[model samples]
Target: MDNPQRNDNPWFMALYIGGAGGILATYILIGFFAARWLVGMVEGPRYWIAIGTISGLVLGSFHIVMLIKKMMGEQDG
Candidate 1:
């Protein structure tokens, strides 16, 4: 049987890379914008952006981890 992970398909690899990157960037952008909007409404401490960015990073990392886990499971199962 042909192993699913053994195939070094460039296009498939590119797709995964693009998807992971897009997902991470999108999450970060969304967090930034959401925080920016919140800041606009309330004037106080300006650390919301940092919180949003960190939140985005954490969520994005979680998504990537889940994605990799699923892919690996598919290959090994």
Candidate 2:
């Protein structure tokens, strides 16, 4: 009998972790630049900081969800 939960390949795990880390790093960089740009706007830096942070979190979560879905689908196949 084959075990569904066991993944013998280490490369997949490494790639997944690397991709997730890259996504997180990208979000952080985007937030940093957005905040910097928004700081010069009339509304002030606080609003832009909040907006950037929230957007980053939302985007990161979405990426994670999509990755999980893709992984599950691949496993099922």
Candidate 3:
């Protein structure tokens, strides 16, 4: 018997992957700009770079965690 819950369409898989990639990229870009602006007000170039990098890392991590949970069909908090 065919499993109704199983998704075998390649187009759907591609779309899902592409959407996730777009979301993560957008999130990182936003984080980078926000960090840069905030750090620019109180620090030098080095500080701005550092803060942007750190913020991007943290936000990227959180995004990955959410993506994993979502892919696993788990409920997000």
Candidate 4:
């Protein structure tokens, strides 16, 4: 019996990189816009900074979790 070949395409790696970049960019944009809006309502730069930092951290954590789940699923398959 022969073992099946694993997918080792460079394009897949490129796609993963591109997808991660896109997600990062999206989070950054979201953080920027959210901070800007918060700044309008709040009176200080500190609040906006805190809002942006918290939002970025939350989004980053979520992205990491999803990425881990995807990698684990691929390994199982």
TM-score of each: 0.78, 0.66, 0.61, 0.62
Q: How many clashing pairs per prediction, in order?
A: 0, 0, 0, 0
Clash pairs, model 3 backbone: none
Give residue 30's error in model 2 in angstroms. 0.5
- Show pairs that collide, candidate 4: none
Q: Which 10 consecutive positions of candidate 3 have the poorest summed lDDT?
A: 68-77
lDDT, candidate 3, 3-76, per-residue tens: 45547688977887787777777777876787777777777565666667677767876887787666656532
Model 2's alpha-carbon lDDT is 0.76
Q: Give one digit per residue, the lDDT tens place, for model 1 in 1-77.
A: 56655546799878987899999998888888888778888964579988887788889989988987776566544
**Candidate 4 Cα errors over 4 Å, as ranges:** 1-7, 72-77
Q: lDDT for each of the candidates?
A: 0.81, 0.76, 0.71, 0.71
For model 4, residues 1-77, the per-residue Cα lDDT tens digits are 22255345789767876887777778877887778777778765757766796787679668966985664455543
> Ten consecutive residues with minimal summed lDDT in candidate 4?
1-10
Q: In what order do the candidates fall by lDDT, top score first? A: 1, 2, 4, 3
Model 2 over residues 12-66: C-alpha lDDT tens digits?
Answer: 8888879988897788678867886888665684677778877887788788878
